[model samples]
Target chain A: MLDANKTIQLSHGGGGKEMDQLIKSLFFKAFDNPILRAEEDAAKLQLSGPVAFTTDSFTVSPLFFAGGNIGKLAIAGTVNDLAMMGAQPEYLSCSFIIEEGFSIAELKIIVESMAEELQQSGARIVCGDTKVVPRGCADGLFINTTGIGRIIMPNISTQNLSTDDVIIVSRDIGRHGAAILMAREGLELESDLTSDCASLWPMVEQLIAANIPIHAMRDATRGGLAAVLNEWAKASNVGINLIEKAIPIADEVKGLCELFGFEAHDLANEGTFVIALPREAADGAVEILQRYGHCEKACIIGNVVETHLGKVVLTTPWGSHRYLDLPQGELLPRIC
Target chain B: MLDANKTIQLSHGGGGKEMDQLIKSLFFKAFDNPILRAEEDAAKLQLSGPVAFTTDSFTVSPLFFAGGNIGKLAIAGTVNDLAMMGAQPEYLSCSFIIEEGFSIAELKIIVESMAEELQQSGARIVCGDTKVVPRGCADGLFINTTGIGRIIMPNISTQNLSTDDVIIVSRDIGRHGAAILMAREGLELESDLTSDCASLWPMVEQLIAANIPIHAMRDATRGGLAAVLNEWAKASNVGINLIEKAIPIADEVKGLCELFGFEAHDLANEGTFVIALPREAADGAVEILQRYGHCEKACIIGNVVETHLGKVVLTTPWGSHRYLDLPQGELLPRIC
Candidate 1:
C-alpha cells in the first residue's frame, strides 16, 4: 500500500514488488474494469470497421487548476479528439511519466480526477503504462492518453468544409488559457474564471444523434480559435469569414486578454469546439449544444466563403476586416 | 524549417506556425505515410475483429546506449508488446514531451531512429502529439508509444500455461540493463556488449508462420527475466522449474552484473522475450526463432510443473534449488 506522506521512489517504477504494489493499490483501484484487470500486455478489444485513433500528451504546468487538473485534461483532450471525428469514445490507454519524490496523495487525486472525467464519455482506461524518473528529471507529472473509438459518422474531416458552410462556436473561448495564466501568475482575479475544461462528448453524441451532417469539427486547444480556423480554411481550400463580435468570450477572459495584450481568439479552450456544417443545420446544432448548461452561449460565429482561399478573415465590430493568420509566436507554454 | 544549430523553444510547441513547421519538416518527413499525412485530429484506420492495444512511456536515461537510443527503444518496446501477444504490429501513436532548449539536431536523430525501427514491423506512426515544457521541467525528452494490432493467435494468456509446458528464452538477458549502466557510469569494459534493443515482430511473424502454439509470450523488460517468470507462475497458478545454466547470459552482461552486485535475471532487456508452449512444440518454436540472427540463442530454459505452485524455482549448476521471487527494490532507474 502507498503511504500518503511517502513520496514516490525509484523502486516504485523498478518493475518489481514495489511497482506491482503501487500499480495495484493506486492505479488499478482507481481505474478498475474487467478489461484492465485482465493484466495482459495489451488489452483485447473487439473493434471493427473504421476506427478513430488519436493521442495527446499533457505537460500542463501547475498540474492542478481551479476547475480541472492535468488528469482531467488528459482524458478530455484525447476523448474530444475522437469525438471531433464523429467517433464514439470507447477505450483509452493512459501512460504516466512521474517525477521521483512526488506525493502519493497528489497522484491519487489526479488518478481519481481521470476516473471521474472518463465517466462523462463512458470510456474506459483499458490499458496503461507508468514510468518514474529521478527527481528533477521531470516536472511533477505528465500524462499521455491514446484513444481509439468506432467512427459512427464517417467522413468528417477538415477538408470536408464547403463554401457555404456555417461555423458554430460551442461555448465561450479563452477561459482555459486565461485560467492557467491566472494560476501561474498567482493572480487573485476575484472572479469565477475557472477553465472551460469539461468533457465535450455528451454534447457531440447528441449532435450526432440529431443527424447533423458535420463537415469539420475541432476542439480549440493550444493556439485556440485562430489556429483552428486557419488550419480548416487552408485544408478545405476555402476562406472562413468570422464576425469578431459574434464569437463568445467570457468577461473574465476578455479582461485577462486585454491586460496581457493577448488576443482572445488565440487563447486555448479545453471544452469549447468549432463546427462547420451546412447553413441549414447550424441552428439545430446550436440548439442541441445550448441544451447543455455550459454551452448555453453557443451560437453562429462565422461562415465559409470562396474568396481569400486558404485564409481566415475576421470582420471586426468597427466594420473592418483583417486576416487572422495562424498563431506565429509563443503565446503561453504548458497551457494544457 | 528547423535549423540544426537552433534549440527547441517554447514557440515550437505553441500550436502555431513554428510548431506546424517543426512537425512538417521533422516528424512528418521521417514518418511519412498516407495515414499520417491525413492531418486530422485522429487517424482513421480500417481495423477489424479482435485487436490488441498497449502503451509504453520511455524515460531511459543516457538517452543513447551502446546498441540503440531512446527512439529505437520506444518503438521496439511498444511493438514488441503487441508481438508478444501474437499480434502483428500495425499502427502506432507517438507522443512526445520535450524539454525546451534541447538541441533540435538531437531530436531529429531520435525521430529518424523511430522511422527506421518502424520498418522492421511495418507499423506506421498514424497520429501523434507534441508538447514542450520550459527548461528543467523535464530531463531531455520522453516518448510514449501506444500500439494496436490485430490478434492472429488468440487465447495466448499467462493463464493458458499448463503442467509440462516448455519455457523458452529468445536470447541472452541483461544486455540492455548492462549497456545502460555502462553508458551512465561511463565505464569502458572493452566488451562488445550492447542493449538487446530490437523489433521482435520479424521473428515473431516467422514463429506464427511455423504454426507454434504459444501459450504465453512476454518480453523481459523492466522487471527482466525474473519478473516475467514469476508473473507467469503466479498468473497461471503453476510452478516453473528453471535450469540456471540453461538461461543464457552474455559474458559482458554477467561481468557487469557481478561487478554491480545485481542479478542478471533481474536486469532489463529491450528485445529478449520468454515464451511458454506445449512440450511437443518447443523445438519448432526455437528453430523458427534461431533463424533470426538476434534470436540465434533461443532455447528451452525451464518447464511448468504442479509442484511449488505459484512460484518460480531455479535449479543451480550444483543441483541446488532456490525460489526466484519477483525482483524487489530499485535495480535501475530509467532502464527502459
Candidate 2:
C-alpha cells in the first residue's frame, strides 16, 4: 500500500528503507550511471597517481548570513578540507536537499554564489543532483559539497609531525567568529569585523613553492585554535605547547570577546591557517606567506613538544594557565 | 553598510565570480585541503594509471516519493554511471540542498539510506556537505553525487564500438516510467508492476568475466531509449537501426502508456541497460547477462551501423518507418 506523507519529515532522509525505496523507484530510475550502479560503500577509482578527497556539510541557519552565506560556505568548506591535505582541489560534486516551496530566486543566488566560488577555487562542478521535499520539512536551505583533488606535492609530508615543530598562524584570530556572534546575537561590537573568508591557495601555493619544511597545516575554524591543536596532536602522535603571548588577535575582536565573556583563544576565524613547521624553516615560511598578503598578521602561535601526549595548555596574559579542550557545545551553529 | 540584498544568490553554482566569494568565504574556510587549495577547473591529477569519473544530480520532487528516496538515488545514480564506464565505483562525494523546516528525521533517513546503498554497491560514503535555505525557498530535498571509480579493465574501451555491433538489454523497459506515471498522475493500472530497481554490476561483472567483446553500454534512464541512443549515436558518430518489435514491453506498461498517450520508448526506466557488442560476441554477452535473476528476459533489440549520422530509425512490426529524436519538452518532471 502506498502512503502519501504530504510534507517531508526527518525520517525520510534518515538513510533507511523508506529512503531506499524512494531512490530505487524514482531517482535511480531517472539517471543511470556505473558509479551509482555499483552501490559500493565508497566510490573506488583505480587511480594511477596519489590523490586527495574531502567532504563537508552545511547546516548553517540564515541560509544567507553575514560574512558568507551557506552557498559560499558549502563549496569553500569542502575545497579547503581537500586543500588541507596539500592536495590541489580539482573536481567537485554538489548535492542539494531543497525544501519544498523554497524561493527559486534565492536558490539562484546561492547557486550563482557557488559557481563563482568554484571558479576562484579552480574547481569544476562536473556533476550534481537536486531533490525537493514538501514544506516544513527542513530549514530554509542546507547544502553539502564533496570534492576530489589530485595530490600535487606528494613529498610534502604530513603523516610525520614531531617535537620542535613550530606552530604558525597566518593572521589574527576572532574575525569570523566575532562576525557571526555579532550577527546572530545582535550585539554591538566596536570593530567592523568581517570574516577572513578567502581562498588559502594563494598563500599555500607560496608556502609549497618556497619549499617550506612544514609538518602540517590546518584551517582554524570551529572550536578554534584548541580544536585544531588537538587534531594535530592526535594525527602526528605528538604534544603541543602554545604561547598565549605570541598568538595574534585583533584588538577589536579581543575587546569584544572579553566583554562577552568569551575566550579569545576559542574564537573561529575563516581564511586563516595554523601550520606546523620545523623550527628552522618557520621564520622563512612566515615571511613567504606575508608576501602574498594572506598572512600580514602572521605570528608564531606555539611550538610542539616531546612531553604530555594529547594535551594542550594555554598560558594567559595574567601569567595563569588553562587547559584547552575541544569546544563541547556549538557556540555558533553554521559559523563556517 | 551591510545591504543584505547585495547578499549572494544561487547563480554562483553556475560557475562565475560570486561563486568565488562563496567558496572563499565559506567552503575553503571549513575544509582547508591541499588539492582543493589548488582551485583548478576540472582538476587535473597525475595519472594514477587509469581512472573513472562520473557525475549525476537528483531533482526528484515529492521528496518522499515511492520506491526509493533521494538519498538512495544519489548513491545508486552515480554508481551506475561509473559502472557503465566499466569502472569499479569507489569514492563518492555528495552535495545536499535542504530546505527550512525539513524534518531532521528525514535527513537522517536519507543519509542512512545512502550508507546502506553504498554498502550494497561496495562503495562508501566518504565526504559530504549540506546547505539550508529559507522556508518555501526550495523543495524538501535535492542531492548531487559525483563518483570516481578505478578502471580495473585496462583493455576495456569505449572506442571499440564498431559496425555490426549487436545490442543487448539488461532488463525490460517502461517499468520505472510506468510506475512514475501511475504515482504522479494517479492512474490505476491493475498490476503489481513495480520498478526494476536493482544494481546491475553483478550481471555486468558476469558479462565482463565472460570476456565478451563489449563495445559500449548505457543505462536507459531519462529520455529512455531516446536519450541513450542519441548519446551513443553522437559519440560513436554512427546510426542505430532498431527493430521496434524486438524491444520487449510488458503488457501492463504498454496498456498504461496507451492510456496516458506516452511513448513506451521514451519513458524512463531505472533497472535496464543497453549494451553493444561485436556480432560474434552478442550471444555470449546476452547469455551471461541473463544468468542474473532479473535479466533472464534480456534480449537483442537493435544493431549499430556506419551511416545515418546520429539518427535512430525504427522498423515497426507492420513494416512502418519512424525516426526517433530525443524528446524535446519535459516528459516527466521529478520522475526520478
Best by the TM-score measure: 1
TM-score per model over all chains: 0.98, 0.74
Task: Give the candidate number with the greatest lDDT.
Answer: 1
Q: Report the Cα lDDT for residue A312, model 2.
A: 75
Model 1 spans > 4 angstroms off: none
Report how closely model 1 matches the true complex, as a DockQ value.
0.90
Q: Point out the worst 10-residue segment of candidate 1 chain B by lDDT.
A: B185-194
Candidate-wise lDDT, in order: 0.92, 0.67
Q: Who wins the DockQ comparison? A: 1
Which tens-of-lDDT digit does each residue in A244-293 have in candidate 2?
A: 88888878778778878787667776677888888999889888877866
Worst 10 residues of 2 chain A by lDDT: A1-10
lDDT of 2 at B47: 49
Q: Could you give candidate 2's per-residue lDDT for residues B21-54 as a string of tens digits?
A: 5455544543344544554322333446556676
